[model samples]
Target: MTCFPFLFGKKVSSDVRRDPEIDEGLSGIRIKVYTYKQLKIASDNFSPANKIGEGGFGSVFKGVLKDGKVAAIKVLSTESKQGVKEFLTEINVISEIQHENLVILYGCCVEGDHRILVYNYLENNSLAQTLLAGGHSNLYFDWQTRCRICIGVARGLAFLHEEVQPHIVHRDIKASNILLDKDLTPKISDFGLAKLIPSYMSHVSTRVAGTIGYLAPEYAIRGQLTRKADIYSFGVLLVEIVSGRTNTNTRLPMGDQYILERTWELYERKELVQLVDISLNGGFNAEEACKYLKIALLCTQDTPKHRPTMSSVVKMLTAEMDVNESKITKPGLISDVMDLKIREPKKKIGLETFPSSYNASSSSDSQGTTISLAASSAATTSTFTLKHDQSM
Candidate 1:
């Protein structure tokens, strides 16, 4: 299978055949093969002004293709060899996936030391940029929009877990990875950390890599990841989308500092209404909102075996199946596994309804369930890698 180099008809390198990573998926797909120079021109030579997003892997720039198509170009960091691997992995996975709720890949560039992925530029960017990283936005994610996003994300996960050939486990499912289209329809992005599990294997053990707040306890502690790990992440994302806050925010009262624990606390007290974002200003449905919260709790249960599959999750969220509260157990606590530090909120927003550290003990807060937090200032970055070392 001899092919010309990207965008150039000339081919002379004999070593191209020996290197699988050089251009593994290029031969299989008919998508546009971009050259580094082409992308550079599209992105204004990777100018800082065009940069839209930055993360562990690389920086994403907003670019206009020669055909007048607007695209998002992700340029991998040259310093990190792992970034290149992630670039190839993303292409391998997302290239085959064609879903309404998944990001559309225009093409990619793998020339010299440059690695870039071109995607359809989403108008709303990401949920993180607009919602989670809140500061300024005309976008109002009302109750219906939030619900639609949840349902869309669930269907995407369902397709990956059930309908896909070998089944895909999205290790990193968070608000930042969720993009919104012009109509605000949700699309799951970033398959760099995704794991492809053959149907025969029940689970795969490897190094843990995902957002700290969304990490499943079993997966984080033992590196044993199954489809349930994605379920747990989706569960955390559900809570965030509904509450209009991140899973972990330090700028709040100790009791409410950790959203997962606070949401659980509200569930235990049968006061799940408290879990809704105050920003909604009483616009959300009480019954439906509570049901979504409960279903999320079901997904993040302590035992992965107890968690419902993504397909079932979709049916439950879409009101196709009645969620059984009796089946839910203790929710997986991320703070319990990692060193989480809580920061004090400003003095203006006093703790009113929630019991703070002062008098939380004697309060009849749902049968005397204690709310205590141990905080540490420790911080560490997250990354993904295979379990290649059998000796370790």
Candidate 2:
């Protein structure tokens, strides 16, 4: 293995080819191959000042290509458990797909052991940083803008699930993965955990991976991944977008700590509109906002079969099709499944009637077990990359 240097202003050879491992991993993928030196210079030697985001896989830095196009460069950490396979997976998945709502892959750098992916930079960052981060960002998310964002994300997921030759399941669909451009148009980023399902396959049985708050009950417990898993996560994100809050906020009262649980309580009381972000301040259409919440409930039904398909969700959102409120049922709440030890309600919501059937101590397989970052407040626990087992 050839060793590469990360020092600033240090001279490096520009003639090196892609690593053999990377070449084999990205055999069929057609994308620009960026040299380590080029990226080093593009990012000002990966200066801390230029760093835009950090996650379990690696850190993302703002860079400018030779063509003068601004880019978000994701540098894979050498210490990360996500190795070359994930690096190639991200490229293979995104390079083959294109949609206005999906992040555009500019290229990648795979010289020696330095693995990096370059993407088009979005000015506003992700929904987690701006909307859910709570006043950390100056960007404002009005009701109309939030509605457009939700619809755009639905269309993108619809494209991934239906229009692609081999349907793609976005394993991780949290707020942090949803990026925003200057127009506030939502673009789904981060494809490292994406899985391609052949037309005939019902589901892919794999190790569970995803944020605790956004993970589907079936996928998290049984490890059987399908498009429905993405739908469940999307359902959680929909609520987050509507309410302008994180899925699980420990700061709130125990009963309202989980967004899905709280949404259900409000739904039963015939006041779903109350779940909308108060920041909207009477500007949003109450009926429309409530409709979106109902659609979210439909997507998050306890039974995966009950969840509407992404295409159906798009129609529901656009008012082309009605959201069948009759079909909405209690959602599979992660907090309940994980037993976050909520203070029992004075009048326990209908939730207690349904016993925890899926509560297993741990995964049976030696594969990674789920980690609930929502349960912890450690400074190192980044909501962005808290999906996989940290011990891995």
Candidate 3:
């Protein structure tokens, strides 16, 4: 294993191949790859002392670089489903994307079969940790700060969806994926399951990949993916942020009530304020809270088209809106609500599995066609004015 200094260092072997196309998108800086042994020493030979956290993919270790810069290194398990392609995709996507509310990918290490991603160390771990701790000392976050986080995340997503040359959809957006720095500024992380959507296409057919509770209904049930799917996930995240609770955590009361159903019930009863985190202690802006809740409800609606675009969501969050006079649209009855009593057969579709005969991939030059407008309309009780168009 070769070791290199971080500051005023001599360049090591040039075995690393540089792809000009990929390098052009980067910040005109080449990341120095660290040998496995160097990382082993920095992480104290992957000792428990340096272990920060663990997730489905792998364990994260806190390490100090030779320059004394602290970083969080995610060491992927050999058996993890996310392989080289997915890992490289995450690095390419996150590195090109620069935003205050999005986590920064410092570099990556790919030594033989070993894969690791290094990111700037965030003092505060994740929103899930804080929300799950039941208002503990380090978990304290004012309602104002939470609201700002929501706005920041919305901006980041909007940039990904609208600004990127080929729009990208973060297939897995959740509380655990949102990291916070020492200043409590929220940054969206995790892009292992993201998909790049070409500008000409309306939707992309892909495997249903995401946490169950956070997945959009259409994507989960029908294998249809779109930017609105991200909106739905963001909606779930919004409720979690406002209420300071996990969607799937049954420990909280109300008969294992999912966040969507609980929020709807509270909305109907005009007790939406009750759903807010008690930690707020009435210090949050009531009008802003209601507005965000309404936007979230719209996003979580069963129908994907009914959900607002990322740009629209950003406007609703930041622009001056007369909440007192605004009329919110109610969410449609979700299919899961009906399926709670009856189980349905799973339908597999997309590149990962056999493609569904119902639709074909749309080409850039072709005019998109509508495949199953009636089926789409009937699937959700929520109605949208937009027409369903597909092309291949």
Candidate 4:
């Protein structure tokens, strides 16, 4: 058996100064401290063949531990200095929480310039790769399975938002981040963009970091984050899970391009049921499906206060509480704030084409103008950064 270091050294890097907060945070956390060599061997020298997923943060690879357990290793791109904060945040957040719907953290590696995260290897990929991306996956997602997945995701969010002390806000809640286990259970992954909200504070002010299509209007514009921001993203994911499509699809007709806009149009016309994916083949409960769509509308309302809490959303989905159509209003659609241009990709992961990731932030410059642009050319994903003029 290969011996590994279980404790972190006095200093992580010789060149970079370690933050006192990170040092204090790491000292108390109960997760295993892995070395660069052990993780490198575990991932077979980070082989390309072991890679299962890719995103702006980095790539995820499937690996086997010395004890014979399977795992997914996430290696942060060395170029992203910002990723170090995310890496530590992920370790600090997930290492303390445990839930069936939340992804499990096996351990992490932080040695020299290398940073990696280890998680239980999920058999099936994410909903974005399978359900919404379509044709690329062989898994069958009938109505019952889809319904269960939606609730499972909602429950996980509710746990984070309500049950956890100093409740957490998952700033990025999109299809690509929702992974599926062999039993088809939904596990919410990626805490890089997560923020913790203490009981006294209503919201936290920070630079915006999340995918474009799923961002809430208030958070995107004002740079103020609350649990409702996550509610908005979850609302979009809810629609995608039910409709089997991405939030933004330029290929569709102009009026039907944005899912939230189309959903609102249908709700007004009493044709909301039409938004359901045709792949269901009349197999789903029409009334329940429509109710789910309505609940989504409630979650995405323009005013943060207008949106229901995740726990209430759970009760609504489970039929424990009534969904008040009287309170449903037009969602805070992404198209209203800025125009998004979708360029044809050189390759595809699923059938539908959409932006892999989007990052925009508020600048602290004297003029209060923010100019940020980031671009990536990964085969399965790409990154697009934008400039922001809004000030909080």
- Candidate achieving the largest lDDT: 2
Ranking by lDDT: 2, 4, 1, 3
For model 2, what is the C-alpha lDDT against the true structure?
0.74
Q: Write the per-residue lDDT of candidate 3 for residues 247-322, one digit (tens) a residue.
A: 6443446443466778888888888888887777888888778778878898888777878888888878886443
- Give all TM-scores, in the order shown: 0.80, 0.83, 0.77, 0.82
Regions of model 3 farther than 4 Å from truth: 1-31, 252-256, 321-392
- Name the candidate, 3 or 4, with the larger lDDT value: 4
Compared to the true structure, candidate 3 yields what TM-score? Answer: 0.77
lDDT of 4 by residue, 289-316 (tens): 9999999999999999999999999999
Worst 10 residues of 4 by lDDT: 358-367
Write the number of the candidate with greater TM-score, choosing between 1 and 4. 4
Better of 3 and 4 by TM-score: 4
All candidates in order of TM-score, best leading = 2, 4, 1, 3
Return the lDDT, model 3, position 58. Answer: 64
Give the Cα-based TM-score of candidate 4 against the true structure: 0.82
Q: What is the C-alpha RMSD of each candidate to the true structure, in Å?
A: 12.3, 11.1, 11.0, 10.1
